[model samples]
Target: MQQMITLITNSISKDLPATLEKSLKKEISSLGPVIARAITPIIEKCSASAVADSIQKVVGDRVVNQLDKSVSAKLEATVARQIQMQFHTSVKQTLQDALRASLEAFLVPAFEQSCKTMFEQVDSAFQKGMSEHTVAIQQQVEATHTPLAQTLKDTISSASSITQNLTAELLDGHRKLLALLASGNAKAHSTNVLQPNNVPVTGPPEVEAPLDPMKELGRLISERKFDEAFTMALQRSDVSIVSWLCSQVDLRALCSMVPVPLNQGVLLALLQQLAVDIATDTPRKIQWMTDVAMAINPTDPVIAMHVKPIFEQVYNALLHLRSLPTTSPSDSTSIRLFMHVINSVLLSYK
Candidate 1:
């Protein structure tokens, strides 16, 4: 039976393709129109709806999602920028506030204290300097001021008289020498005071030779040999000569021509002499002395050292002037300082 079935399957497998193909072509051709008519509208309707659903799902959902994503990103960026701006502003404001607070807390108080301290120091110093000066001057000037001024006047008059006598004597000697030369006697100019018999005269002759130390000083000063004149003036122990030297030597010349340290000594010595109440040269002395004081070099230890001594003498005279009712001006710091530098220049020459 299996052999019969195998034989039959082989025969059918050979015939099946030819017969089935013809019939299948015929059936498909006949059913194609029927299937098209029946299912085409339904398929077309379902396809249209499917395409609409697909478009809505794909395009609309994707657009909404993209818009949402973009909006979120932009919002995030704007928020970040705002936060950054706020943060920066906060930091800057904090720094400024801190600086202001620090200044108010520390720097302002320190500056104010420093200013107050400085002003207080200045006030105290000014008072101290003035008071000490007053006491010292009061102690030093025991004698009446009138006598000193009167004595200065007398001394000046005496000096003038001596200068005149010396000058007259010089002129007379010149005249005598001229007369002798004209008279053909050449020996008249000689230092010897002898008679025609060549013997020494018994008594003092008409015009004695002048021996003025003051005159020698004038010569040195006039010759610009300041150092020598300065030395000679300082070395002389005589009060009158020192006074003479003090009255004569210009402080300006002393400062300009002489070397520093030496000039300092000369200046201090002159100031000392002026302190002795020589009212004769007050007007001349005050102006330049004030200028010298104003121009004082802070770095000069010698000049700085000499200030107290210089002021002692100057204020001595100033205090005396104050005591005199007629010449007393209002109490002024400048006036006190000015009147302290005392005396006149040497004008013994003419």
Candidate 2:
């Protein structure tokens, strides 16, 4: 025992503590991981058991056992009241702020609609007033002009009677003139051209056209060489050529002859071609027209019916000329020419 004590004391007094501390420091660095590894399972086991026990106490029926759940109902009611109060005031306040930020979204359109309705009402009233005013003005205008309109209507009505009376008087004078021409004629005309069976009338001695030219004219009329016949007749310097031709030839059969059926308009134009202005005795005008009218028979009621419009036009032209203060020689000649043609050729069937 004494020897063991002495050896321990020497070992302690020797490099045992310092060498042990150095070896322990060197190994402690490596041994720390080993110690942690060894104690980790034990520490983890202890912590898990403690936490499980704590969880079981809290989450299990421990609170009921510990406090008999006396405050749970009050705490739940407190929490619900707090949450409801927060939702009612705080959430509603936030929603109100959001709605206020977007206030113009609905309000602007509503304001525009209200304005539009007001404008439409005003416009309708304005248009209604204008329509009523226009009607009033129209009524006034119509009332003011009614008398003038009636007077104008009456004047127009009387104008027609005046025109008809004038026309009838003019026609009566014309018939008298024609009768005078027939009665007072100084020349003997062949009735063969007008009245085929009438006996010859003895009047003033007349210079007769040559028999050959008259026979040639008859041949041309029979042959239907109308244009050639008319050219020959109009080309003759003597106005008596037309009277002679009408007196000798069947002019209706001559002028109406064409390869194709001509319109009455063409026949009218052809008849008017016979009106050539030649300087001749004024008395011969009525005589030539008389001879032509006898052939065409314009004085006949049936022929006159067809030639009424033509006579009216000729009559109107003459009246218009008379209305003029003075007339050119050409205008007077044209009027006379038109009168001659109407009295003779246009009244013919051709």
* C-alpha lDDT values of all predictions: 0.55, 0.52
lDDT of 1 by residue, 1-350 (tens): 99999988988898888889999999999999999999999999999999988998889888889999999999999999998899788977898999999999999999999999999999999999999998888766745666888987886676656545443443333333223322333333221221222233333342322388778889877887664565455344344665565467665655654344234334444444333433445555455455444334433443343355345445544655454434435343435656543222111111
For residue 123, give model 2's deviation from the true position in Å: 3.2
Q: Which TM-score value belongs to model 2? A: 0.30
lDDT of 2 at 16: 92
Candidate 1: clashing residue pairs, number: 5
Question: Deviation in angstroms for 307 in model 2?
Answer: 21
All-Cα superposition RMSD per candidate: 21.1, 18.8
Candidate with the greatest lDDT versus the true structure = 1
Q: Which stretches of candidate 1 lie over 4 Å from their true place?
A: 1-211, 237-262, 291-306, 309-313, 328-350
Q: Give the poorly placed runs of model 2, Cα more than 4 Å off.
A: 1-104, 188-350
